[model samples]
Target: MDFGEYDNRKNRKVESGVPDVCKSEPCMMGIDEAGRGPVLGPMVYGTCYCPIAKSSLLKTIGFADSKTLTEEQRDNLFVKLDAEKANMGWLINILSPNYISNSMLKRNKYNLNSLSHDTAIGLISRVLELGINLTEVYVDTVGDFNSYQAKLKSIFPNIDIVVSKKADSIYPIVSAASICAKVARDKAIKNWKFIEGDLFHQFDYGSGYPGDPKTKQFLSENIDPIFGFPQFVRFGWSTASSILDTKALPVKWSSKKAIENSIKTPVISNFFGVQKQETVKEKSHKFFSERCLKSVKNLF
Candidate 1:
């Protein structure tokens, strides 16, 4: 409840409810983020001060990878965590899709890893304002582990940072931070849906992950008119770009030149000394066929 006194130095890092190598060190803070990949919603970063003595309590709250837990499970865990902890502080940055798009356009690149690291650093800096004698911090790596640590160090020259891949899975405090971040993001998304009204109603895009069929359907249907084919959807990302490009234009071929140019005319290839030419159809047929082939290949 008293966010003012929260300090990273009073919390120690533990691995899966057990104190291992990090036990000898003093308490530290754990940081993580959520909703980085989603085309919708804001990017949220969370940091928590977990003491070495309360590692068991964190485990009992179902602390694990946020990706592995359901929304209900995360919400439940977040509630329990809020009730048990007093040294936890959260900082959320609500970046709209439009703002993200503009940044990508201005930068001429989409750097999600860098963006995530920056957000995490912002939250960590806010936590440091309380002057909790925080010497060290742990974060789930968004880019090169060492680079992320260095970036955090540059921002907060005094704080020692450890950035590891899958740190949430390996560190109990990091996992707790993950749950907090996820729950906060999910709540923000739900609230956004309520505020956006009918726009979210037509598109019941379940979480914004690529694995979600509803999300893909929503993107396919609305990306062109509503979201527009811009940097907001991560133009560098194949999925986002593919959806935007495919949906932006109409399926119908307007002219003979368009159809002819679109056709995939295969060149002759020698297979075991035998050469053959394949006549490939144009437009949707060829595109759908190639996509299907690629999908089939990935499955095996």
Candidate 2:
């Protein structure tokens, strides 16, 4: 519940329970994300796992899709989940709005779907790293359940991976993951401390979706003539960028032409449009392709 850690790192995790107990039993894990569609706060990836036999206990506590639960009900369930710490574990990965915008707007265009997949994979990897005897994983699908499922399976060949359109509703573990993500995101938004000096002071950004009139009002009212938006806004989102392009002053980068040449196109980009159509792709280092690292011209 501490925002201090999150304030320091745009990306951070909240972990509950240690792994020693999990190492004794076969575990089932689930992952779901929150705030993906919002033009506001961080997009969060949540994961929770328990002994396969104890998963039924999750259903007993009324873990269900976060969207269906009232804020009070979700809060109550979040507390209940923590009370079950003896047999369950959970982790939340918070990807800040700034990080999301940076990744999506990077010269190579990292894109959301790729970011989601990578974040989900990283969560699973974290569970494994903590020494859990993980055997199964359930995921709420992001794009093309079949392809996404296949991709997860390929990376984690030993685990039984299931990606379903409504896994968050169908699986108690996935629902629990949704609760983890939703509650954390809500807390993050409520306590957000703008490093950008006082502009407007309020937590009235509405639902943070593009369609919300209050959110529209907030974006329009807060726009800076020279700078695009505060870090809280996802500057790369079409919802935010479309406004910036029309309202904010234009800024240009010097490395508009070239930087890392050896990076190859991400496979997920083939499914979603993240590539430059007119610009011919440049080849990347074999090491870069193999390790997902890119050579930067400068550290700054």
Candidate 3:
């Protein structure tokens, strides 16, 4: 696999096989994602493309829903795809935990669903932009299946898109994408490196899921004075929220109501109430008027 950063450093893109899909006949591709539930590591979006007719080649290699396969099985399947690079190509988008947290915490408010949609769309758009003659796209849905399908259809009106439940299990190409995503996420978790002077290691955090006792314990114990946990943890998650609220310095928030209440406003009398008028002072006599100037000239 070739590893590199996307134009934006927020995410990394990995690709395998340098097939010229444009020159060859049209092909079908699949898109799927992994690690959406984990609070640690990156959420990876994976895409696999191959000649539609050669899809049987994928089935022969035992590609299936990655969740059903053991870690070793997934690793072996990746090796198979690597060996058959000439026939199949795959790509992945690694959305780091830092990236995910920052995006979620932005003032504009980017949710996970939108992030996932954009990431998947980006990968598919990238493949097509690379001049690949992609015909059909199959994807597993994270939310409303129909809504996601509609979104893809609007983007690729010329191509066919199938968004369904468990597409990774139903479609061979999707299963291949699942393998790529799952393997990439697992590798990221396994190779996680903490920065210098950090007291905690990746193992101390377990799988980085909120339900994991180790992960919860790590978040509970590692609350920083200002920054919370290291970059490995998602500070925007509820787990971090609870810890910061309870253990770290108390965070005070100014709500709209509180601000409005704090502002002072002068009371206004009723429109029918009597009004007070200012007394008009008599016009002060001008010092040395025309008559006074004449008298002064006579004296000179």
- lDDT per residue, candidate 1, 197-249, as tens digits? 35645557767776678767766765545335322233434566677666665
lDDT of 2 by residue, 1-300 (tens): 454644612687889876466888999999999999999889999988999988788989989999998888888898998888788889999998878887887889798999999999999999999999999999999899999999999999999999999999999999999999999888888777666565544647799999999998889888877755777888788889888888988887556334444445678757777665687778995434422346776643
Q: Give all candidates' CA lDDT scores.
A: 0.60, 0.85, 0.80
TM-score of each: 0.64, 0.82, 0.79
Off by over 4 Å in 1: 1-27, 51-56, 108-110, 194-199, 223-238, 246-300
Which 10-residue window of candidate 1 scores lowest in summed lDDT? 6-15
Comparing 1 with 2 on TM-score, the higher-scoring candidate is 2
Misplaced by over 4 Å in model 3 are 1-9, 196-198, 252-300
C-alpha RMSD for every candidate: 16.2, 11.7, 19.0
Q: After aligning candidate 1 to the native by TM-score, how far in Å is the CA of 294 from where it should be? A: 41
Question: Where's the lowest-lDDT run of ten residues in candidate 3?
Answer: 290-299
Error of 1 at 132 (Å): 2.8
Superior candidate under TM-score, 2 versus 3: 2
Error of 1 at 131 (Å): 2.9
